[model samples]
Target chain A: MRVRVLYFGVLKELFACPSEDVEVETGCNVGALRKVFHGRMPHTAWKSMAIAVNQEYAGDEVLLHEGDEVALLPPVSGGAPGNVPWKKIILPSPRTV
Target chain B: MQIAIVREVIDAGSITAALKAGADGAVCVFDGIVRDNTRGRRTLYLDYEAYEEMALNQMRNLAEEAIAKFGVRDIAVVHRLGRLYVGESSVLIAVASAHRGAAFEACRWLIDTLKKTVPIWKKEQFEDGAVWADGEPFPEEIVRG
Candidate 1:
């Protein structure tokens, strides 16, 4: 089966392309697919990437079919106002308490 | 009308206006801009990219969830794509409600949630080099399951 794999951010830079068609065995799972995907890119590229099939995050054992839109998502930096991550911080001791 | 992933500059005025309606006491607007520096590094610009289909799906879901959870009357989320210079806004959100508290809280939750789950990525270019910004890790539940 062939999967249309998409890349973004660091993954795109690592793979040197935005997307490509990947060939894999029929009945292959995402975990198995990772092996083939990683082989085509630099070693470090897969360290932090998460796999998404057709937009939803997929677990390692998720079965992949032909023509699936798979993406290699890198560590994201927050974009837009509604696109930021939250950080927990301990504040300096307060005076009013 | 409520969610958009655009390449053009974010129009805060229009977005804010879209959320305003009669009887709403306050409209809270949250804007995320491209600054001149990051961690003391001089930033030249930023490039944003997204898994458009997934991003839009996630964003609209978040907006609906915010309305249900926060009881906000209206909410708008807009994220910009492509190259952006310093001082430009990359994201903007507007929330309105009959009271101020829900709008403010919803705005905060919207940004926080979007950062973690929306499939958007940003690359920061600096004077010396460029790199992708490190985002928060996915929650254990999402990552493990």
Candidate 2:
């Protein structure tokens, strides 16, 4: 079987490409596929990366089928830091009566 | 709910205005902009990228979850891709509800959750060099061994 694997964030820079097609065993799962890259790329890079099959997060147990769109997601940093006000209000301590 | 991943500049004011309803008492908006600096380094610009389809899916899920969990009346999440100069709106999130509390909570929750879960990445271009911004780790459930 073959899957279309996508690279995002630093993975794209590391892989030197945005996406590619990879050949895997018929019954291969996400873990097995990850190992294939781990063998070639720096092991540390794969440490925080997650897998997405057909645009949804997939666990290692999830089976892959041919033509599946797999994405390699590095940790995400999307929105900017929000200026949310402090949640807890500080009150004066009660004086001894 | 309105969810989208667009490459063009995001119009924050219009989107927030569009999410308002007669029954809603408040509409909270979070407009994420490209800052001119990162950790004291002068930033030239930022280039954001995403697994487009997956990002859209994740954002849509967050919007839906915010409505159900926070009981907000409506939501709109829009993220921009490609190069963005300093002060440009990179993302926008707006939430509407009958009261201010839920609106604020939902808006905050949506942006916070989206930062951790969404498949979007930002590359900061500094005056001296460029580097990918370190991302917050995914939630434990989303990571696979």
Candidate 3:
């Protein structure tokens, strides 16, 4: 399977390219894909990065399908007003945008 | 107007009018201007970029959530990309509601959330050089290994 991977923000700077298509085994997971990225950049900067699949943040266990869109998001720096944690600020309805 | 990631110069005046409603008594606006300095560095310009598809999605989500939570009637968020010199408006958010409280709360919430959740990144260009600034960190739960 081939997954289209994207890099944004500082991750784009680290990857040296915005996007690329990577070959992965069928049903590979995000952690496995991270391993691929880790192999490419095994320095301290690659650590603690997040991954998003199909526009939603993904956990390691989430399985990847063919042609799936994956993104590497850098460490975000913004927060809710007055240091409010984002997890506590739940939306009343998670509507599809 | 409503929600946008534009490359053109943002017209704050038009956006302010766009958020106006007859029923609303208060309209709160937050204009995130690019200053001439950051941490003592003389910033010459700034460059913003976003994860286009995901950015729009998150922006809409933030607006809808604000309306539901703060009871605001209207919200307009416009962000600029590419190179912007100092004293330029990098992002603009306007919230309108029947009362001042909701409008104020929504405006504050919108910009903070937009900075954190939306996949937007900014690079600060100084007289010496440039550096990318990652907005505040995402929640620990969302931060994957």
True contacts kept of each: 0.42, 0.59, 0.36
* Docking level of model 1: acceptable
Model 1: how far residue B57 lies from native, Å = 1.0
lDDT of 3 at B128: 52
Please give the lDDT score at residue A40 for candidate 1.
75
Question: Which model, 1 or 2, shows the larger lDDT?
Answer: 2
Model 3 chain B: weakest 10-residue lDDT segment is: B126-135
Residue-level error in angstroms, candidate 3, position B68 = 0.7
lDDT of 1 by residue, B21-45 (tens): 8989999999989888765768788
Return the top candidate by TM-score: 2
Give Cα distance to truth, residue A92, candidate 3, Å.
46
Considering TM-score, which of the candidate structures 1 and 2 is the better prediction for this target? 2
Q: Candidate 2: TM-score? A: 0.91
Give the least accurate 10-residue stretch of model 2 chain B, judged by summed lDDT: B126-135
Model 1 steric clash pairs: A80-B91, A81-B91
TM-score of each: 0.87, 0.91, 0.86
Write model 3 residue lDDT over A5-94, tens digit each, in one string: 998766676667999999999979998998888877635446457788999988888999999999987655321112322121122332
Per-residue lDDT of model 1, residues A1-97, tens digit only: 8999998877776667999998888999888877777677654445556788988888888899999998887655666422333221212332221
DockQ of each: 0.24, 0.26, 0.22
